[model samples]
Every structure is written in structure tokens, then in C-alpha cells.
Target chain A: MGTENLVRKLPNDIGGDEAGKIERVEHELLPWEKRCHALADVLDFHKIINTEEKRRGVESLGAEMIGKLSYYERWIVAFANILFQKGILTPGELAVKMSEVEGRFSDVPDTRQS
Target chain B: MSEQHDHDHDHDHDHDHAPITVDEKPGYFDLMETAVRELLIERKLFGADEIRRQIEVLDSRTPALGAKVVARAWTDADFKSRLLENGRTGCEELGITFYDDTQLIVLENTPAVHNLIVCTLCSCYPRPVLGLPPDWYKLKPYRARAVYEPRAVLEEFGTSIPDDVEIRVSDSTAIIRYLVLPMRPVGTEHLNEAQLADLVTRDAMIGVIQVGYDREAA
Candidate 1:
């Protein structure tokens, strides 16, 4: 494809592109990943954001971030941005809460709350 | 060379970096997940327990659910037709609840034709029945190759389809997900539905591999 087409093409549109061998690796979902998924469900269930909105949210992240981040990583990041766009949560609020949460995990590397 | 080696290992030389490093700090995304979730709860958009319940619902789903439907179709001809006609209704008959509104299309494999599913745009999958897709399914290569050269992709999973067999690749979208109903292996006529269900692996349902019957010695 030409540069013009590539520029217009969405990042997730990778069908029929030449690619390497498939790595058949099965990863157990970490606790945070499951929680991220659940957050998606909760967000959709309550109409804060629907599934299509979330899909578009991830797509809006562009190709570079999509390729670099893990699946749920893209989602969590997208969710934050989408929330920001919707004015549901501000960046300042999220940053403050993240620091507050981070401080709670003293001496423990796992920062997720039980 | 020694100077270069020292520069590379300078940060790590202070600590014993073994084969497994357990004390690694969390990444930015990890913090974002906690922050986003906590903010959602504190804002009363949803309660924390609601998220917990949703996780429980997701955990309750697995490939066993898909296998049960496949085994039933193998034994009951009526169910097979129904599943082919409308997958969501067919699965609902088996008491499986679909949380989403996306349609489920069950593709059947025969001697002359094979079916494979891929989500090129994103990781759209039949999560209600088969749970989350395998890691390979969500990756770029499988999504890119499966639509064009499905036979080659299947071969990577150790499933070789003869040239005579037409490979029908289904590209899933956000609105439609697919499940493959693989052919039952021969010499398993004696096996019960439960026994047959046990043989239907996730890979088989994904159409990457055939359900192999390795009969334990009686």
C-alpha cells in the first residue's frame, strides 16, 4: 500500500498484510487485566460508555500506541482518555488518585487493591 | 569492550538480577487501571462490588461451554441445524446467556470445506461461549494472514487442510462473532455426549486445529 492509503487506514486494519509467524502463546490473565475487563463491562453496563464507544476509543489511539501497548493496556489507557473526553473524569483527578493509590502500596510492588 | 559492558550493566550491577525478577515496579498502565477504576467508583458511576460481580461473570465463562454446544450438535441433528441457522438462539436453548447483543455465527467444517475465524480490526470473539480469545488470535499475524491464506495459518496450528478443501475465513467485527463446529473424529461413535464434549478443545472450536481423538487404551 502507498503512504497515502496507509495514512488513511486505521491502525487496527491489518488484514492481509505480510507478517511473521504466529506465536501460539497462551497467557494467563493477570488480576489487573481481569479487573480492566470488568471495568469495561461495568462502564458499558451503566451507559457511561458503550462497547462501540470503547472500540472507537481504542482505534482512536492510532497505530503506534496500538502496536506498542498490550491489549488491556490499550483499553485502560483508552478508557482514561475517553473518560476525559466525556468530561466524566479529569486528568488532574486521575493523576491525584493514582498517586494516592500508589502511596498505599508501601514495600509491595503490586499496587492493585484487593 | 569492558567499558561498554560496564555501561550496559551499571544500573543492574547494584542488585542481583536473577533469571526471575519479582520485585519489579508496576508500569504506567498498571497505575492507570487502579486510578481509573477507583475514580469510577468514587464518582458513583458504578460501585466497586459491581465490577467484582462482572469479573465473576467473565470468569464463569470458558471453552467448556462451547464444547457442550458442539457435543450436543454432534449428537442431535436438530440442534445442529438450529445452531447453523442462528447461533445465539441455539446456544440459548442450552441455557447459555449472552450478555452482549452481537450475533454468534457458528461455522461448520466438513470433508471438503474448512472454516477459520479472525478479527482483523480488533479482538472480537465469541466470548460468551468460548471466553476470551487466545493470545495468538488477538495478535497481528494471525489477523493479517487468516483472511487470505487460512490454510497456511491452520497449518501453523498443526492442522493441515488439503488443497481440495476450500478454506472459508470469517473476519469478525464488533457486531458479529464466530465459532467453528469441527467435525467429530471417527471411531468415537461409542463415546457419550459428555465424553465427546471433553475432546473439543478451544483450538478446535477456534478452527485452528481438529479435535483429535486419542482413545486411552481400554
Candidate 2:
């Protein structure tokens, strides 16, 4: 495996390797995450949270530009959708994102053992 | 971190076919969940369906529909005052319930101090209004840290409470739950009830995000 350009991302407590692992998984699952855009166009979380055309304007940006938002923004967009779609954010909801792979950039392998 | 969990029902912890980028499999929430579930069932503590049934029961309350209540309150000061006094009842009027399992705590968001609510123990929440808890909110760190240092946590979310505004962290334990009733946004006296509801997000109400600021109008 090439070690030159492995962009690492993770929680505060986890180390670089750990963060990198999660980031790799998240990236693999969604290299170009656009559930937020779908939420804006279909589910509509952007307007609900920010209450505006620009702030919640994930629609106009298109998947091309949305693919460019920071990982945090992408997560936030999903977060907004959670608040919108469901009246409350529920436990184990994160699994939904990991599973949703329609038109995604990376294909993360679901290694969750049951 | 090992506990007991017996899963008599069909459980799904299948994250198998992800990608090469996900090298180390940082964490497996299901592993812990299974252990805990097995322990409970083995101990005759609870069946999987009982726990699921409990959530189903809690979700039956009226306050679970939060935004509708907030929108109504934002537009009606009288109702807002009622909400401050009794969040559950106020929610009831708007067809919201705190659910049957948990006691609901309503933390009003004032001008001086913004109230941010998080669950430190488990994912204890005002399910009636808020409905379900977020994935990250159930984690150990978010549960523990958010209460101790609300400001630091908010900073991570890209929100920093001003020095002038005091930050209040409310942690809902097993029985008690809290909700942040956001301060009414300024220059919106003329807006209708529908317009105001558009602005009151669950994030602002929970304090992860703050209301917008308008300097020019000020």
C-alpha cells in the first residue's frame, strides 16, 4: 500500500493511525458524500437548520461542489438530515450513513461482525 | 470495556464490505452492544423486545414533536411563558411528549447563558420532542465531555459562545432530560409563526449551534 498520501481524519482522543482508519472507512464509504444535498433537495435539512437559501443551499452547489465540502461539513449535513427526517437523533443511526452507498465516491467494506 | 449482552433476536452488526481505506476498523459499536445485550438476557434483566418495547412506549408521548412546539411557542409569548414553566405540558398542548421512560428537563436559552444539553450516562433524551438520539451522542466521550466542558465541545462543532454570554451545560441522566428553549431571534417581530419555526433548529435548541446574528440591523 502506498504510504505517501494517506489523509488522516478522526476523533480527538483517537491517535493518527486510529483516526486514519476511521477516516479511511468513512472516505471509502463516501468519498463524495452527498446525502446532505439529497436532504436539501429531497429531505430539506439545510433550510430547516440555517433557514436560508445560501446557508442551506446544498442543492445549488450540486454533487460536484458538495463533493468538495470538508468532511466535517458533510457530517454536519447528515446531522441536519437526522434532525429533519427523524424528530430526534437516535442511537445506532450512524450505521445508516455507512450503509447508504448510492453514487458514493469510496466503497467502504462493512466489517461489522455480528 | 467488556460487559454482558445476550441477543436472542436477529442482530445486525454487518459492516463487512466497506473499503481498503478503512484499514484498522477503528471501533465496533455492535461488539459492545452484543455483550451488553447478552449479559442482560442471561441475568434475566431484560429481553431484546422489552428494551425495544420501552423505546416504542417512550416514543408515544406528545412532546416528541419538538419543532412544532417551538414554532408555536416562538410565535406565542404566552405559550412560550407556559413552556418555561412546564415544558411537558407546553409540549402536550402542541401534541409533544417527553416519552414515558424518561423525565424531561426544559432548559430555556436566555440572552446571558446558552443552555446546551447532552447525555453523559447513556443517550438519555427528551424523546417526546427530540424523538431519537444521534449516533455520536451515544459514544463515551461525547456523553462524558459535553457536560464537563460544554464550550469546548461546542467549539469543536464550530460554535463558540461569546464571553458576554454564559454557557450552561445540562447533562440528562437516566431519569431527567433537558431541552434548550432558544432565545427569540431579533428583528423578527414582524415574522409570522411559520417563518419563526423555520429558524428554530434542534441544534440551536440543543446549543450545538447558535442563532444567527445581524449586526447591520443592530
Candidate 3:
């Protein structure tokens, strides 16, 4: 489809429900969100690159992944990738660590509810 | 999202921006972030203490800080000029630090123009001043529509601009964060700075709502 035609179909097109119906949802912060915040703070100390560079690396992960991941989740992924690239952490080690975390949390009840 | 441009001039083109959608359940992202954080801590790359400290810093911030700055600017012409000239320095003059490298650009609302802020890519907010961004600000619908139909967005927030006023939507990025300095409401001349600050709401600073005095109370 042409770019102009695509733009015309956007929700913001005149008379669309895009703007008027957008209600804000208030959800409790998920565990991942808390983890992301912590990870973001940790990543702040890295002298290798700036926040913009880290953001670019996350954006380079393609729109599908970008859209799927939450805001700070993207930051963690970018930080992991940067660490891997710098040889601070190896892919093999990270994969093993990820499996370990998954195994550790598999039996725990989901804490999303109080 | 590829169409990148600075705030130098207005762009006339209308483009289809995609909405940011995510799954309800935790998935790879959660596991990845956990694994990465644990690994980093174990490796001594950064300590748990440092992470906690950072979170503490973020937790201490709230919209009240922005309101204080706005209230000061409202009553002080010199401070207002300083804020308009350089937001970072202006904030520093009031003892409000940037807290990070991200540049803070305060957009002033006037009779001729109304300003709205959004981070289409991600929720890049001025954490030091405004605390965390509200959920709606990070949602897909708002991110997609705020730039394209700002007037309608404002209307949804109960803010109606006159036809003569122009709306400028500022899309924030990782490098620069925006804070909207709403015009002080009328009938507030008698109010002191503390009283003025009381009138400022988080939504008002985000430009989704206008700051106004309660007519019945006055």
C-alpha cells in the first residue's frame, strides 16, 4: 500500500475512535517491571555507551520484538546484548543463566496478584 | 517511526504510526531481565546496593517537583525567561538537578500555542521531576495517536483549545525529555506560590489537562 494511503487508514484519521476512546489502564506493576527498573539502574553505570546508543541497540531488535517487550524489558535485552558483544558475558553463560532463572521460578506461584 | 526529525520546523506529512502492543503474560522479557540482572550482580559488574540506590533516587521524585518549578516561574518573570532560554540551567537555578544526562526541555503553553508530549518509541519521561509516567502515556493508543491527533487527544483529557490556538506535539526520545509548563490559570493572582503549586496536577504538567482554579471554591 502507498504510504499516503496507509496514513489515511491510521486510527487518528478524522472521525476515528483513536483519540476520543483511548482510556488509560492502571495495572499493578508486574515482577518483570520491577526487575527492569533494577536492571536499568544497574545499566546506568556502564561507561561503554550512552542511553541513546543502548536505545538504538534495542530498536535494532526489529519491531516485533520491540512491540512485544515492555519498556524496561527492552533496556535489559539491549544491556545483555551489549554485554555479550563486549565479552563481559558469553551467550553460552547467559543462556545457561536464563534456564536457571526459569527453572527457579517455574514452581513459584505467579505473584501478579496479592 | 523511522521518520526522525528535530523540533526545528513542523512537518506537514501524515504517516501511519504503529501502535505498541505487548502480551499480557510474562515471557522471554521477564526471564531475560532477571537472568541479566542476576548475572550482573554475581559478576560484580554492579552491586545490588547501587541498584537499590538508583531506585531510591527515582522513588523520591514526583510531579510536585515540576509543580514547584512551574509555580516559581509563574510568579517570577526573570525565572520564566531563564526557563524558556535553557530548561536545564533554569531547573538547576531552582536546585532541581537533571539527575541524568537526558536534556529537559520545558515547553511553555501560551495563548497562541498548546504543547503536548509523547514518547512514541518508549516511555522516556523526565523521571527526576515527574516520577514515573502514567500507564496511559506508555500505552499503544496514546503513543500512536498523540502525534497525529493532538487536539482530539487533548479533548479526551477535557482540555479544549480554541480554534485560534495551534497544537504542537513533542515526541520525546532517549536523549531529550519534555515537560509542559501550562499557563497559570486565571483568578490565581492572589494565590501564593504554595497555593499555586497546589493547583498543579501531574496531568497538567504532562499537557493532558489544564491547570485551573475551582470556580466554586473561589
Candidate 4:
């Protein structure tokens, strides 16, 4: 119920699969990865962008990795994961990548993680 | 059944996101986009106009950029060596900065088999060089299939590998990833850069599409 309360305020895109999994970095991952993973958790706030009307049924919860989750969320996490793997990208660069692919016309997409 | 998709197409359609207005002034959400854009700008992260310029650059790109990268590898020995040495730099030399120049790694198709790429996690793609991914590539069908059933995925895109040639499917999960520079086609020797570049479509370079004869002239 507490998780539901946390997600209920979201604009509709950041709900499903986010429960428990979307915890604060200090409490999210194991302490071993708390440093970098926590840093990544900080960037997770950008999930708000997923609220754009163009996207539907997208969920950023780790559960979205399942095909059953909304395609938009799955793609978003996947896109984020790509940026993570591509070393040297700051959070700002990641945001730029998102803006570029926000449309069908832009060349940015996950097919080329670069 | 053939009727399956028809039934799926009947899924609910919500209009809350697309409220109509006379002259269609920016809606609350468009205002939101503006706000977000402004926030990013206000923070001095990136300018709104720079984003527009990036869009313009993406729109203007052609498959030729990839083709030149591929052709240079094919012709000049020094370039080929560099491509082999570092695919990212190779892309830069050919005017393609896939990912930041430091982040990309280009993989080539060998005589024994071909290569194709999939993000598996999401559509992690190289927008800098290849441009926006095709709609199908962005679909769950492609993402799911590209991993567990790469051969099947390739088949859907009209590409198939002979059993003799190894079909290597590279998952671009990390920055140091690979691109499938498809093997040269038959009877295409001596093709000029323009013609050669024509062979390098985003899909072909990804190995979803095969290297084909210069059929455009026909």
C-alpha cells in the first residue's frame, strides 16, 4: 500500500513494476553497489519523461523487463541500460539521447547504442 | 489465426492525451514539454536550439555515411586496418560518430558468416551514424526475437544466413559494442564510393538486411 501511495502520484507512466524495485539508492540495491547503482538510481527520476502522452502502458519498474510490461517502459529501461554500458556518458548526455529519439523522425534509438 | 491481429487492433484507444482545441494552442502537456525543455535549458545543461539542430542533423543523414565507412574499410588498407583496430575511430574517419567517438565498436562480417545486432534490453542504437531506427526495429517483435531467435528475426526482415556461414548476433549491451559491416556482395567489384555507400542501409549495416547487388540502377 505504501508503494502504491508512492506511485499513485505519478502521471500514469511510472507505476507498474516500480513497486519496491524503485526504492531510493540508499535502500534500493545492496550496499556493495550503493555507490554507482545509487548514482544510477538518482538518474531514475527522469522517468517522468515517460509520462508524455505519446507513450502508453510504459512502466519503468524492473518488472517491465518482462515482455508483458508496456513496450514503452521496456524500451525506456533498455535505452537507459544501453547508455550505462556506453561508458563516458554523463546524465546530461543521456538526456540528450532521450530528446533525440523522442520522435519517430529523430535518428536516436536503441538499435545503435552509440 | 489471421484474425488475431484484427482482434488486437480493436484495443481501447484513449484520447485524453490528444485534447483538441481551435488553432490547437499548446496543451497543458505541451506546456509540460516546454517546461521540461526550459528546465533543462535553465539548468544550463543544453539549449533548446541545439536540440533542434541535432534533429536537423539526424533528418539530413543518409545511409551513404555508413556506406562510405564500409567502403573505406573495403578499399584502403590503412583504413581497413584502422577499422579493425578501432571501429569507433573508423566511423569517425568516415564522418560517422556513432555514440561519442570513444564509445562505439564496429564489427565486420567475415567470409565464414555474417553479423547482426540487437539491443535485447531496449532499442539501444547508434542514432549518430545510422539515424533513427525503423519502426519495426523499435517493436517488441524485433527486440524479443533478435535475441533468442535471431535467425527468425532476420528472416522477418528478408535476410537469412546459409548454415555454412556463422550467424553472429551481437548484443549492443555495452559501449564497446559491434556493428555488422556486411560482407561485400558478388559482382560488385570496382563500385564507386556512391554506389558502395548505397549498399549500406541502416538495416544492412545491422545485418537485418543483406548486402545486395546495386539493384537501384536497375
Please tell me how candidate 3 rates in CAPRI terms.
Answer: acceptable
- Which residue segments of model 1 deviate by more than 4 Å? A107-114, B1-25, B216-218
- Tens-digit lDDT string for candidate 3 (B1-218): 12332222232322211111222223676777767767777777777667666767776778999999999999999999889888888888978776677788999999998888988766788777888888888777788788888887888888899989999888888778898999999988889999999999889988989898986785
Point to the candidate with the largest lDDT.
1
**lDDT of model 4, residue B87:** 75
Note the Cα lDDT for every prediction shown. Answer: 0.84, 0.50, 0.74, 0.50
Query: Per-residue lDDT of B1-218 in model 1, one digit per residue for the tens?
Result: 11111112223222111112224335567768888887777677888778778888899999999999999999999999999999999999999999877899999999998988899888899999999888999998899999888888888889888899998998898779999999999989999999999999998988999998967752
Residue B165, candidate 3: C-alpha displacement in angstroms: 0.9
Candidate 4 residue-wise lDDT, B1-218, digit = tens: 11111111222332111112112232222332333334445455444455444445555565667778887776677888788787777777866654332255677788787787766544456555665455555444555566556666667667777779877777664344566677778777768766777766777887888777855663
- Identify the superior model by lDDT, candidate 1 or candidate 3: 1
Angstrom error of the Cα, residue A93, model 2: value is: 31
lDDT score, candidate 2, position A111: 44
Which scores higher on lDDT, 2 or 3?
3
Candidate 4 vs. truth: CA RMSD?
A: 15.3
Off by over 4 Å in 3: A1-20, A101-114, B1-31
- Against the true structure, candidate 4 reaches a TM-score of 0.59
TM-score of chain A of each: 0.87, 0.26, 0.62, 0.24
lDDT of 2 by residue, A1-114 (tens): 554433331121211121110010112223222222222222221233332332334333344444465433533444434343545433444344433321132232334344
Which residue pairs overlap in candidate 1's backbone? none
